[model samples]
Target: MNFTDNLAIQLKAAGFSATTDQLSQFTTYYEMLIETNKYLNLTAITDPHEVAVKHFVDSLTALDDKDLIFKEGAKLLDLGTGAGFPGIPLAIMRPDLEIVLSDSL
Candidate 1:
């Protein structure tokens, strides 16, 4: 299956749901991440499966309390967001929330 299919399955299994467009955005983000990692040490988990589960899915776990974090104008700070981790995924998942991703590099 494609990234969208795989991601959707995983998210569903985790009691979450994502639209095709959202999954597509994730796929784009994944592509950019892999491409950028060619020069910079962005991440060690290069495999698509690992990235989906470890980076994308794992990052989303931070939003277990969707009611709290998914407010209309919620502000979130993802400190030490290595390679954008939960920040990127969170942004993708909740575009309405104001998210700040930072790292000490």
Candidate 2:
């Protein structure tokens, strides 16, 4: 099974529903990471399973409290967000939340 399929199974098992657009973003995100890693050292997660489990799964785990995360007009700041660990994924999952990814490079 592909990473997207495995991610779906894992999310469902975690009692969350991942839409096709989310899956597509996950796939595209992984693909872009892989492509960019050729020139830059972005993430240590190279394997699909590892990326899904460590990166994606870990990111989605924070969504357990959907109500608190998506409060009306919530502002989140990710400080020193190198590659945006929880920030980017959180943004993707909850577009309603405002996010400011801050980094120094």
Candidate 3:
């Protein structure tokens, strides 16, 4: 299965739902991350599955508390957001909320 399909499956298993378009965003994000890593040294985890689980899934853990994470117009700030980590994925998952990704480097 492709990255989107695999990500969808994993999201479903985690009690989260992602539409095809949302999954496509994740796929695009993943591709960009990997591509940028070639010169920027963004992330050490390059394997697709590792990125899916370690980066993507781990980031979604913040959504376990829907009350806090999904609050209308909520703003989330991910400090030191290397590779966009939880910020990017959270933004994709909860478009309603505002996410700010900041890094010192």
lDDT-wise, the better of 1 and 2 is 1
Worst 10 residues of 1 by lDDT: 62-71
* Candidate 3 or 2, higher lDDT: 3
lDDT score at residue 41, model 3, on the 0-100 scale: 96
Q: Which candidate has the top score in TM-score?
A: 3
Query: lDDT by residue for model 3 over 1-105, one digit each (tens)?
Result: 778788888888888888888899999999999999999999899888888888998899989976654687888899999899999999998899888999998
Candidate 2 has a TM-score of: 0.87
lDDT by residue for model 2 over 34-56, one digit each (tens)?
A: 89888988888889888877887
Clashing residue pairs found in predicted model 1:
none
Kindly give the stretch of ten consecutive residues in candidate 3 with the minimal lDDT sum. 65-74
TM-score of each: 0.89, 0.87, 0.92
> Global CA lDDT of candidate 2, please?
0.81
**Any runs in candidate 1 off by more than 4 Å, and if so which?**
66-70
Preferred candidate (lDDT higher): 1 or 3: 3
